[model samples]
Target: MGPLIRPLRSFANGLGLAWWARVQTHGPDVTYWFGPFVTRGSLERELPLFLEDVASEAPVSIDHSCLRCRRGEPFTIPASDG
Candidate 1:
């Protein structure tokens, strides 16, 4: 695997559970934050596409109250998605 994929896979494996992933924008940059994810393979498969979309958009911010909710808990819905 490439450098990016390696780290992503490692991160997912380290979590040991599914979690939600969200894109947070700041000025010209974007941040990817993780939350309680419902499906295992969903984020893994869609991550690349999601990043591409974010890149194309340049700068966009999503307002989510649950950005850090249930951070370490397992099998819980992210506040943002709820």
Candidate 2:
């Protein structure tokens, strides 16, 4: 039973799809912390629409974090080995 349940739990955690609905309904704010691979411009452009979609039920705060390059823009950095 333990072995069977572990796989199911891992799969569920990996999916993380349920959180979207849950957050939309319950969260006042959603913070998405991403690695340095995602572009800031893309996020800035799309986040408003995403927030609007999620806020169809109620308003919620949306925030995120990413690398900053010399130009004071969102930048991507490779993950450290350690």
Q: Ten-residue segment with the worst summed lDDT in candidate 2?
A: 17-26
Checking candidate 2 for backbone clashes, the offending pairs are none
lDDT of 2: 0.37
lDDT of 1: 0.49
Tens-digit lDDT string for candidate 1 (1-82) = 3567645544654565435565566554444555443444655665666667666766555432222223343422333422
Q: What is candidate 2's lDDT per residue for 1-82, written digit by digit as tens?
A: 3556445434543554111111222244333323221235644565566556556746444334333322212222323346
How much is 57 displaced in model 2, in angstroms?
A: 1.7
* Candidate 2 ranges with C-alpha deviation above 4 Å: 1-37, 59-82
